[model samples]
Target: MTKTPPREALTLAAAMNARRLSKVFVADQLGVTPAAVSQWASGHRPVPPEKAVKLADVVGTEPHLISARYAELQTNESGNVVPIRQAADGADERRNDLVIARLENDVDSLRYALGALVTVMTVHRPAEGAAVAKAIRKHVPVKFVKQGYVAELLGVLDKAGHE
Candidate 1:
């Protein structure tokens, strides 16, 4: 009786097989050739970081799950030298922090512009000021409008409406 060797685990090929996806289909989704997919499937080449994320999306898994290189990049970016074999919650938190920081910056810019707009409308177009303020409040979060220039604008609009 002949015994087959144990199959390698934690491989891209395994992930694809579990999803029941063919190499040609995956290659088409990734805009790569079937030969390229074969190389990755056979573990002859590591998936490049640029392609890793897209490949993960194609396979319905996280990049680190399918690509050691992506996991290495995440581990290194976190300022740790320890090799990670899977995605960690800490990595997700770090990525979320980056997105939140960018959104906060954009909100700050919007606040400044909205403040200037309110001031202009109040001075030259008093009748339109309340409408504009209402529109702004409707679109912006309550917490945002409750502070800073937005707060001042709402206060002014309220007083104007009362008088």
Candidate 2:
């Protein structure tokens, strides 16, 4: 039995993900079983050079990147995989910042919409009430409305006292 080339194996996995190609599809295309594809992906069986070229074409990626990554994986087989902590941390921070910005924008927009709805509701009756109710009901889920029932009751009392 010949040892499978590491680069070929890694390239196969990367190509699978990058192309969004399934093992079943690849197997069918390659005239092989899904288990065989799985083995190749797991680095147990290296893809042959001819198959590697075909995979690169199918995956729409430069064959070199896949080959290089595979080589890197081969060199790092000392049982200690370097953790991509910094990249993960950076990704997490960026994700949090985006979530915060989105939340801030949503809050601002909701407040403005709520204020406008209140003003419209005050000026217009029956028709406007129905429209505003529809708008609110559209945006606010039944579960959320039910959860806020108590707060809503308090808000009604607060408004009554102020008026």
Provide the global lDDT of candidate 1 against the true structure: 0.72
Q: Estimate, for each residue in 84-116, the C-alpha lDDT of model 2 and write its tens digit.
A: 232343544554465577689998798677666
Q: Give the lowest summed-lDDT range of ten residues in model 1.
A: 2-11
User: What is the alpha-carbon lDDT for the whole of candidate 2?
Assistant: 0.57
TM-score per prediction, in order, is 0.42, 0.33
Which ranges in model 1 have alpha carbons more than 4 Å from their true place?
1-10, 76-163
* lDDT, candidate 1, 1-163, per-residue tens: 9533223214677778889999999999999998888877776677876788788788776776666765655654545533233437675666556557768999899978977876777777777878877887999899978997778888887666655
The alpha-carbon lDDT assigned to residue 84 of candidate 2 equals 25
**In order, how many clashes per candidate?**
0, 0
- Give candidate 2 regions above 4 Å deviation: 1-91, 130-140, 147-163
Model 2 residue 26 lDDT score: 81
Best by lDDT: 1
